[model samples]
Target chain A: MPKPMLKRSVQQTQTNNVLSVTGNQKQNNQNQQMNKMKIDKLLRQKRSKEYMDALHKLDVGGHVHNQNKVDEITNAIKREFPEVEISGILLGYVSICYLGKPYEVHTLDIASGIIEHYKSGETLPNGMEKARGIALHGGYEFIEVYVDCCRAVSSNGTVSVISI
Target chain B: MSDRVISQANLSYIERNLSAIHGEIQALENDVDAVNNNVKVVYDQVGVLANEFHEFVYEQKKANRLGQAEIKLVQIRQELEKKYGHYDIVRRTTTGILQADDLGIVKKTTISNATEELMISTPNYWLAPCLVALSAWISDQPELAEKALREGIKRNDEKTSLFFAIICMRANRKSACLKWAQRYLANQDEENLDRKAIIVIDAYANGLMGADTEGVISREMTKWLEELAEKPGFVEQQTTQWTEAINLKREPIENSGYTYLPKYSNTWPVLEDILEGANLHANILAYLMDIFEQESSSAPIKAQLDKILTSLVTDFDDEELPLRKKEKFEQFVVEFCGDEDRARQSMAIEETAFETHKDFTQLLTDAAMKPESSHASVATQKFAIALSKEWILNAYNDVIAQNRMKIPTEIEINVDTFNSKTTDGQNEAQLVNEFTQLVTKEKEAALAKNVLTGFDKFLLIGGAIIAVLGVGMIFGNPLGGFIAVIAGIGMVIKHFNKKKQLVINEENIKKNYEQKLENGLQIIRAILAEVVDFRIEFAEKDDESAKVVDFLEQITPDQYVKNLSTSNRRIKM
Candidate 1:
């Protein structure tokens, strides 16, 4: 019983509604993409304790020049922070080198190695050598190794509380 | 024909019905009183428990038992956390009892709802909103707290408005609070009791905002002192009492006759100790010298001012400091002005100033430490001593007034204006007697002002309904017009009666307000006199340190005229 113009108007409204719904879907997809990008950027910028520890281990591993030992530590880091995507890895003279996500990584296995050295009642320098091994194997350029309560070993081989 | 048909019984029936309604209203009033009492008792009990908890924590800390203190704190936090409601709705008794600072220990987002249900049935009571706002502030959610304050302000009551203004001031929204206070004062009657209270409150807020309080404070002090001079032995007694109290390291014994001591002595040793410190004196010197520097002059005062200023700049070299360090110094100044914990660093600046002005510094210190041995000149020194005490006491009162202004609770709002009428014969007198007992015990006159009028609307509505019923009867049958006429007359009579009672009630409240104002003024004067007495005694003891006084008098810069004469002599040479 509706007029022809009225019927056309109703049809036009339905079509517009469908278009708007698609538009909303597209907007939501863009938002999700933006959020993912933001998260990725933040992850890249963040320099956490794990990253510092990883760097320390890498520097110590370079000093020791043990390729197999360094490779094992890198594999351990790969399993720990799975969110980090690795780019490349290489073993060079006087250093077990690699390239990957600019983020920190340390595993339970690496932590236990440091803890065991402490359990043996060794001096801090001896325990730090264990931390250096993990850092070298992990190929971390900037890292920190937790030695004991309120103390940590940095890539510089300095044992102190975190201030900056 | 309708008038002729009017019956005496109809009129009697209307009167009887009206009487019954009055009885019901009285009963409702009694019920409200009982409920108010119950709420008060609960609040009092909670207050006691809170005090006990505070004492327990204090004891634990005093013993250096951190572990026990931590446990106790956690237990308190857990209890508050359990009763937490929605973030926006602060309508919970437990929320009121929970201190805002303690709420910081709990997780944010614990509360889930904006409760529409009022915590207390008392109209215009803002206890819940204040609690919620404080809790939100402690949680670092200022926006949410501000929203709660806005809601509290909607009550449109003077005490509530004043409370909000204080909160705003605390939040560092100084200009906003000032504007609100100005508007509040503007709206009040010139002679309103609340106006005087608001004036003191606003003045205090102004001081906190770093406004110069010297002008208003001087006027108030002069007025109070003049009034105090009339009271025999009052000033001398207060001075002795406060001096003794200070020596004993205890609060001054309150003499009921000297009621103003509390208000006047609010600043107590706090401001005096600050003035004694090197920093505040340096700041005052800096402020004074800065003023003279702006006004070009050839005088010894100007010369001395220039020396102090130049030394400060060269020694500190504060201008050349890095931007961040300069910012830190500015922050220190702000803290010092606020009298906050961080202001300790600002006080250090005073020590630096003292090093520069060693003689002046030593003089003040010696005067405070040394005793007066000038017994021969004691009578001569009395006037100077009293004058000096008055000046110092007024200055101290200024600081106290400003500090008290920062905390709104320091100023008490009088809410005892609500009183029952004696217009309803025996019933009216009985009601008045009942309310006097109830109100004195509960002390919630503002709440009474709001809830007590609830029955008036019902009475109005009942009278209208009776008239309507009479109209309905007449519309159905012409012979029933007499019933309608009687009902109409009854409605008019009741309406006039209620209106007259309202007018009388308003007059009574107005009279009470005037009386309370006078009483408030008297207390404030008493407070000023108390401090004057205490400071005078302290100055009397220091009067014996004549060497320092003589040194200060000789060394202090002479007038510009004298300096100009010296300059003329030099030019002649």
Candidate 2:
């Protein structure tokens, strides 16, 4: 009888050990699933916020950028060719030729200010310089050169430069 | 060891996939940022281009206006020259006659010899009437002049009639003068007269009579004088004689005074011719006095003549005098009083005459008020008034200039008011109104465009970013990211295309401006051509015409060359 009872006790202990191991594995799987879901949600939320911020920045930047370009063109035109009366603002990319080279100038008010020249090139400082150059050359070229300084402010408020 | 190995592999694979997704999202965000930046740049460029176009258009308008103004100025100058250039005629006549040795139709040894020979050789039937007419006219014989005129007319000899008319006019036989003048004018054909003969006839008829005729008479006289003055050969001699005459100097006679006496010798062949006349010497003296009285510088001579005329007027009774003499004397008084002061006095007479002889006064008033009559009278009167005014104004101007006086307070104030009224206040008010309308429209357009561009740029960037993030959220959304990139590129292309179209529109406007300028120049050229023709005709002299032609030539070449040069420059540019 003593021999049989010892065997039974050993079997019971083995079963209890198996059950505890299974419970521990299940708890660990649930915790891993929950952590994965939490991480995915946080990442999506961060990405959306970044996109929203970028979009807002872009909108504000566009307005500021346009305004800055106008100011730069106006200043450049005023400085280079002071005689050209500024009349009003207009919009578009205005390319002006200065000193035989073409440069693009941006302006918000075209009706108010006098544009010296038109050409295709990189950004220029003033419309008047191109006009002056054309005048000096007896209007020989297709473009006018303005001798003016322009103020440009970046949209991000990071850069401000004067072109002359 | 086996379980640990399985977990590590799975974790590593998931981490690699997540990193790839995150990389894609970053790439998409960068693409959006680039698009946004590009849109901003394009917007700025468009603004500048628009401004340049506006300036170009304005300059073109200004140039057109200036060209038009210059053309108008040229036209006005030509018109003024045409209207006022004829005043140089009177100075020509005095000089031409002063230098003539023989005032005969044909060259002769002497004017008197020619006259006597012509009178003697002519047939008695023809000669007798001409002699009587000439004698009567020279002696201011009123009844004999009428009889002589009638006899000449019955014979129907135009040449003799013309001679009688000229003589009668010179003698101041106003009635006989008018009758013969009317008869001669009625018989004459203008086409038959050469310019020189016409000039001589005009000078004799108009200049000697001092008729105060206007229109064709005055115009022709002025034209003749202008032509004569411009002749280098005649100008100096004529001007010198005029100055001498005006200064009351004894002018040199080309022939001795008696040598030319034969012109009147035939008419006085018998003692009866001189003695049987009605105070022939007194008539000659009276005629001379009449001519001198109107133009005399000596006040006493004018006063004496006035007294004589006044006495004659008071002494003569209208019914008691012979009909012919009464008619002749009345015509003389009417003509004499037709001068400037007389005209003013006659206005009062006109009003009184209207009351007593209403029918006659109405007829006379109607004649005076007629446009043709006013045209004839007003032209001369205005010219005289203008001459007097110009003289006074010039003298006043000289005084003002010499004194260096400040402008009068009244004038200064008026000028200030005029400037402010016409220029500052008026123009500013107009400009403000126009500008307000323009700005409101333009600003609205600009704002709309700006917002649209901003929204488009934002959408392009935002969509790309969102697509990239979505792809990362899903396992691998490559298709979505690819679609976003395509849309962004399309948006950029669309924006660029829009900008290009705007540039084209601006170019079209510039082209239109150039076309308008060309059209305006053509109109100006046409106007200038008309002015040139008018100036040439108006100048009416060989030398003046030549000078005008030269001036026109100079202007034409310069204008044509300027136009060609500008066109060539435009092509080159």
Candidate 3:
């Protein structure tokens, strides 16, 4: 009697399990996958944030070392390409090659900013170095060594530069 | 009277002459008054006579004399009518023989009889006899045709031959047309070809004369070419002609094509030469294509034949030139109410059309270029171009040589410090990569030169050496050792400061190198782009010579006949 009762109990448990598994299983499975995807995305974001924070620390140290370099580039731009600080790259080649001079001193400074056009093609040589060039890109351009940098300006003021 | 005169001459010369002159003056005055009175008396008598003369002269007799004068004027008008009136009959009959369904000689005697009557009335008119013969031939009266044709030839053989050529062509009598054309060409010298010969040639070249199956007409034209081409400096003359013609097709090149080359390169002149030379190929092809692509002239045969016959009748023969001139002057005088000056001015305005002669080669070019002005059809233009293809080929080859000579082997890229050249522009990526490596080496050299290196290491080593020496000195001489220690300390401080300066210098160099590398790379790449365009355009245009050759190669007589399929359907009766 005890053996039969145990088997009967096991059968009842199996049937209940089958009904529960079939009923609402599709809905429950979708909910489980969605929750798992959300958890995984959050973990990835947390990892990426930690990684970026580490990278930012490294970049900060690099900036501290190159602080003088940035200042030096700014002074060079003031000396060679004075207006490039305010004007955009449309006037770059013309400013460098102005006055029919094929070669000119190229000192450049670039900071992230929206591009604005310099309509006047006017340029003045200010304490320009002789016989050397610092390649200018985006806003300042004057340097030419043995290679050419091809560039295109989109309508929305984005300058796409490709070095060949 | 002699004695009285002698007595007056014998008196004092001056006084005697004066007195005699006064007496003569009085006598002349008296005579004038006497004549005035006599004029009055005669006027009164004439008035009386005028009244009686109407009674004496009969009205019927006056009318009879006036009628006789007008009758003589009518005869003069009939003579004038020969030029304007009777020629219409002959021309209409001749044109009708081709267009009218019936030779109509037996059924419709009206026009043929009128043309026959013109031969008798206008005996000296060359076309009159020719038209009579053409009519008789249409009537199948072979005997009558022969006699009148003999008369027509004797009068003006050239006109007779041209007349029959056009007539036979219009009649669709292929053999007779060729024979007549050969007869006309036989009498022609190249220098003195008649305008009518040009018309005949236009017809022949247009293939309006149907399929010249025997090629006899082509042989005749070839003979004319052989003779003309054999002349001194003929080839040279043709070369000059074609050179001018081809040179006209060349257009001025605009500066907008090459954006950078003009600014940076001195190689612009050579580049311009090649570019313009290439442009000529497109221009020449487009010019020919514009003509060839036009719808083939689909003028019906009757209209085309009518235009030819109209050219024949409208043009006067040399023998009838005086009569035609007289007729024109007479007509003008009548039109302008006998105003001789106005008549002469009017005649001068139309005088240029009187030139009924043309040089053969000049005619060919004129017909090709100004087809309408030279009275040429579209087919004639095509034929003229086909005929002169050899000359065009010669000139085109010369054009190719001259321009190809100027193509640069290498293009120079000049922009400030970036001065280099490229022979091959297609491998832009490889060329760019190579340029970058070269610049890197150059930048390294510059950095070595501009920025001091190894000085920091030297300073550090020197500072340690001085410190060790000071320690050793401290044992021997305390004061000296103390001073040495202080100096070493100062040296070590200076080394730190020097190392800082070195970092700044290095930063400056790196920035300069990076910027220069970027710009230089861009410059070389941009210049290579222009070179690519130049090389591609030159080769593309230069290769057009083959197309021209192919164009010329396909223009055979057999092919020309094939092209005539459309006209062939409409040409034959």
lDDT string for model 1 (B1-573, tens) is: 676557666888889999999999999999999999999999999999999999877655544443433454455445433433232233333233232323334443443122223334223445456555655655667887778667666654443455444444434454554554444444443222231332232233223322322333223333444554444443333333323322232223234233343334443344244223212323333322342334322233223322432332123222223432433444453444333344456646743634322121122212222214211111112212222343223232222222221221112212234333221122433444454555444433632463325455555666677667777778677567657657666766766677787667656765665555455445433443444454443234323223322322332211210111121111000
True contacts kept of each: 0.00, 0.00, 0.00
lDDT of each: 0.39, 0.36, 0.59
Error of 3 at B213 (Å): 1.4
Give model 1's DockQ, 2 decimals: 0.00
Least accurate 10 contiguous residues by lDDT in model 2 chain A: A153-162
What does DockQ give for each predicted structure?
0.00, 0.00, 0.00
lDDT of candidate 2 over A1-164, digit per residue (tens) = 99889999977786577567666688788876665444322221112232223222222222234545345555553553333343321121222223343422222335443232334433334343332221221111112221222212112211111123
State the fnat of model 3.
Answer: 0.00
**Against the true structure, what is every candidate's RMSD?**
43.6, 49.2, 40.0
Worst 10 residues of 3 chain B by lDDT: B564-573
- Candidate maximizing lDDT: 3
> What C-alpha lDDT, on a 0 to 100 scale, does residue A85 get in candidate 3?
34
**Pick by lDDT: 1 or 3, better one:** 3
Candidate 2's error at B320, in angstroms?
A: 47
